[model samples]
Target: MIITESLDNKPAAVTLEPLPDGTTWLYLRKNAKQVEADTGDETPDAKPWQCETAIGKLGADRSGETADTINAKFDDWWTYAAAWAEDEPMPTVQEQINAIYDTLAVMMGV
Candidate 1:
């Protein structure tokens, strides 16, 4: 699968394929030209590999010496992103009780 999306306002592409056992393989290719100085260029010769592991589990960050390394970076970012997204306080005990009571009331047509 070729995912063409803009990240950080730059065009990015991610290619993913599935292994025989339902594992996904991901590849990040630099499809656009860049100044060599600014390039964290992924070696185009790198082959796709299964997306698993702490970093590889999400196929997010694609810059690293190896597939595993790249995925590891992604895992780090994902952890932060997930936590940031859910940065809310837990419900209080009374709030939880109220929710249960609300559900019970609906169940009893109250």
Candidate 2:
């Protein structure tokens, strides 16, 4: 089974294969989607990058409180992780995801 990770790099859709050792080999696949930036109620056009900023701690800033805030946030974090993976010293995949979740937890007060 293939897994598509979310913006936090949380792996999804896990699959397995039988190995000669009578053990199952686990496999994970990331759903790579073309990220599109938040158009802010406007139709986007003629932009190569979904986000305005390519390289940084996060791909985009989503400090806005809007109806599409969740979607925008997913894209923002997802793009940020992608960019961070491309260039810069980043934490482990698990760490990155944990950080995002932790932040969310704090924000949500859960």
Candidate 3:
């Protein structure tokens, strides 16, 4: 099965391969358009990120898991894990506490 979506405005595709070793491998094709643009070629020759996610413990049935749902999960997981790369670093412990206090104070009209 193949799932394609526009990741960060670049065409990306994810290939789901069910392996014989009871593991499902997810392959990611990232920056597909960038490769073509950089090479000045219409054909994309980007090497896909193979075996990005492996599902071994998961049962055979992927209950109600569609391309959109899987993509969203991958997006959220990547966002949280790769925050340092594209966005501001996560807040410090003190900053988090202060923000929580500020929000509470505003809610309580303090």
Candidate 4:
């Protein structure tokens, strides 16, 4: 099942997949607009980050679990992921400069 949800006020696609081990996996793909706004990527087809959350045995059994229970589990994972993404640190200016320099050197026949 795939549903549309919000992450950090941005639209995201959430997919629910059942694993062979009876566990569930939820995949999230954030909107491209959010990616462009966050990374300044101007590519017409730039792809955003795809994150996955594993629903262990406790949250599995789609047939047995009620809709509310599944929704709650998904909501919890989504909230946690959003918080984690917000807390992630960006590269320092020096680090970015060094990375650019490295890329340029390789491009110019390193």
Residue lDDT tens for model 3, 1-110: 23333333443444455657654444444335422223335535653232223221222565344446666677653443233232366599999999999999999999
How many clashing pairs in candidate 1?
A: 2
Query: Clashes per prediction?
Result: 2, 5, 0, 0
Residue 13 of candidate 4: its Cα lDDT? Answer: 45
Candidate 3 lands at a TM-score of 0.31
- lDDT value, candidate 3, whole model: 0.46
Local lDDT at 71 for model 2: 36
Give the alpha carbon lDDT tens digit for every residue of 9-35 in model 1.
333233345455544445453444332
Where is model 2 poorest over a 10-residue stretch in terms of lDDT? 50-59
lDDT of each: 0.43, 0.41, 0.46, 0.50
Instruction: For candidate 1, give the lDDT.
Output: 0.43
Give me candidate 4's TM-score against the actual structure. Answer: 0.30
Give TM-scores for every candidate, taking all chains together and pairing residue i with residue i.
0.28, 0.22, 0.31, 0.30
TM-score-best of 1 and 2: 1
lDDT score at residue 15, model 4, on the 0-100 scale: 48
Residue 99's lDDT within candidate 4 is 100
Residue pairs with colliding backbones in model 3 are: none
Residue pairs in candidate 1 whose N, alpha carbon or C atoms collide under 3 angstroms: 55-71, 55-72
